[model samples]
Target: MSDSEKKALSGLTLDQLVEFATESGLPAFRGKQLHSWIYAKYARTFDEMTDLSLEVRELLKSKATIQLLKLAHLEVSRDGTRKYLFELPDGKFVESVLMSFDDRPSLSACVSSQVGCAVGCTFCATGFLGFKRNLSPQEIVDQVMSVQRESGQRISNIVYMGQGEPLLNVDNVVHSIRTLMASVGIGARHITVSTSGIIAGIRALSREGLQITLALSLHAPDDATRDVIVPINKKFSVAELIDATHEYYEATGRRITVEYVLLAGVTDSPEQARELAELVRNLHCNVNLIPYNPTRAEDGVVTYARPSLDAQHRFRKIAESTGKTVTIRLERGTDINAACGQLHNSYVAGP
Candidate 1:
């Protein structure tokens, strides 16, 4: 079988790895060694598994593959944020970001769940590239592994806020999350999944009982405004999405993160801020205001501008008046087009 057709061992659980070992005529203890090498040590090639016997390594190589993504380009921002453009086995591209915080010592990796997005959020650049396909659970986990291997820094947090709408591929996403927790040793609380208000996906995630944080991409407070920017809102509606978040909170006992993009004149107005405040007044949530990152204008796409510093502060003041936790997101990797709403695979195809 071709390498692509071979079972990808990266996404399998520990027990499954053990099963693979025993089924291959190797002892069960070999699987425990495989787990430590593949995940804990971030081994990318069979050759890296030096502890395994040469014969066993060669045998395993014929039946399974470890690495899935090839690093096509790496752009490092002045502020230490690294943007990785990875070419999949099929030649499609996806981007991941490694961000470092000044206030904390932890590093966060932002990963993609799909090659491109189908949600078609007008304000997001990923939607303009159009949809390709859902990334497998192995591909999803490989992103974090690639970032961790490249940076040589332990990723303390993982966020599904890059390239595509995560909940659209809920099954693979959840599967990858379980592997991340079980194999990689990253706690569920450190992992976050962001969605463009897919209510059914939200309900489905809540039922999983994982303690991971759920971030709702509610860029606008009302349905009318949300319909224009986040098209998913048209189907789910603002009220229904909010209700879904409440359901998620009730089920998981975790505070939801409401992600609002601060578009210059479109979504950053003072009135909208007040409306946003009233919108989530009762829900147990925190607000993350992302000032828009400029995307290259296209023929038919709306040109969105970042809110001025004064405008961003004004909106923050109004939202904070409601006494709910509110903070502006720290902008990172904007110079390299790696910031929020700026990931569109432009490196592969020119804008």
Candidate 2:
């Protein structure tokens, strides 16, 4: 196997890294330097680590890389939101978003786990790219580091809702989460993962008992409509999704986040809103209404044609009328394709 195919250094736990270094005839304490380089220094290359002995660095260089991802394209929106198209070594591409909101005692960064999405939510542009492969834990962590490198602002909270569906890539997703919780020094409670309701993944997460949040993209109220908007609903119905979410809450004692994206005439209707409110009332959850970001369908026709300012207000009322607490997630990054499903990296083009 090539160095890239060899052991992924970024995924190694601190103890595992120390073990690897010791087994290679280097002192175990050398592992601290590696972590410092990988996390603290964010070294781009093994050779850039100035503290390691020349011989030791050469021995390490013969085996692994100090890198994971590089920026392919970065577009800064007029509103200061930055979208990054990062190209992995294998040539597959994924996107990450950096949203700068007013300080609220903490900061946040949203990262992706796969190149394109297999989930194909009717509203997301990442689905347009389709699934390529799962990002290694290293690849996943690199995204956060890249944002830190570019913006110089340390991220306080992490959200896995940028590109591909996360839970589908469970092992790497879990590893990334653990790395964030254990090695990256972020509290598990501060991380949130959004998914398209993959039951198996939810069951697995429940068993692991992670405190990380799970946000379900519940675009429609009923199975018939949900099957059209979120295709995965055909396999895991609304009832199953709710049950899985309850399982998560039972295991972790944390409330799940229900993400409802409002399309112009579909999910934004007051009736749909009422159904959604009632549906979640039976579960342990909160509804986050996302106004659909404008983008073309795979067929090259525009979907989500107009913004739903009026529908938004009505939907909130319907939820509140049902005594459900509701919050509208404000849209950001439109000027630079920072909106959801708009980061058409291919269209981002040779820059």
Candidate 3:
């Protein structure tokens, strides 16, 4: 079999790895060692598994392969945020971001679920690139592994907020989440999955019993405004999406996160902020306000500007007046086009 045809060992669970090992005529302990090396030690190549005998290594190498994403390009912002562009085995590209904070010792990684996005959120650069294939569980998990190896820091938080709408690839995403928790040792609470209000996917995720945080990218409060920016909102609507979030909270008991992007004139008005506050007043959630990050203006793409600091503060104050927990997201990696809604794979021409 070709290398591509070989089993990818990086995404397998402990039991599955043991099955692979025992099926290959090796002892099950070898599978446990493989799990530790691939998920914990972040091994990239089979030869790095030095604990295995040479014969066993060669046999495993011939039968299975460790498929880690190849780092294509990297950018470091002044704020110590690092953005990585990875080239997949098929030559497609995906982006991952590692963010470090002055107050916290642990790092956070934002990983992509698809090569490009289909949601087509007007403010998101990734959506403008159009849709590509969904990334496998291996591809998704490997992003965290690669970032951890490159930064040499423990990634305590993982966000599925890069490149694509995570719920679009819910199966692979859930698989990767389990792999991250079981093999990589990241807890469910530290991992967050953001969606542009995919209602069915939200319902499915709530039934999974995983206590990971769910963030709805409800960029606008009303259906009319949401339909214009987040096209998916047309199908799901603002009220329906809010209802799904409430159902999710009831099932998971984990408070939801409502992600709102403050576009200069479009979404930052005081009235809209008040409307947003009232919209979610009864929901068990906190609001996260993201300042728009400007993308390169192509001919057909609509241009948007970030809200001024004063405008942002006014919106926050209005939302806070209703006794809602609201916070303006601290911007990161804007200098390198690596901030929120800025992962467009600009390193290459287009998707």
What lDDT does each candidate get? 0.88, 0.78, 0.87
**Cα lDDT, model 1, residue 234:** 69
Query: Which stretches in model 3 have alpha-carbon errors above 4 Å?
Result: 1-6, 340-344
For each of the candidates, give the backbone clash count.
0, 1, 0
Candidate closer to the true structure by TM-score (higher is better), 2 or 3: 3
Residue lDDT tens for model 1, 68-118: 787888889999999988888898889999999899999999999998789
How would you encode candidate 2's per-residue C-alpha lDDT over 1-351 as one tens digit per residue?
A: 477665546645688788878877888888878876776665667788888778888888887766566677788878677888777878777778888776464667889888778887766667666787888887898788777767777777999998888899988989888887776677889999888999999888788778888898888889988998788888999998888888899899998899888788877877888888888886778889887777645434237755457878888889867666789887778767675546554455421
> Candidate 1 — which residues are off by over 4 angstroms?
1-8, 298-301, 340-344
Could you estimate the TM-score for every candidate? 0.94, 0.90, 0.94
TM-score of 2: 0.90
- Candidate 3 per-residue lDDT over residues 105-166, each given as its tens digit: 88899999998788888877777778989999889998988888788778999999988888
- lDDT for 135 (candidate 1): 95
For candidate 1, the lDDT comes to 0.88
* Model 3: ten consecutive residues of lowest lDDT: 339-348
In model 3, which residue pairs have backbone atoms overlapping below 3 Å? Answer: none
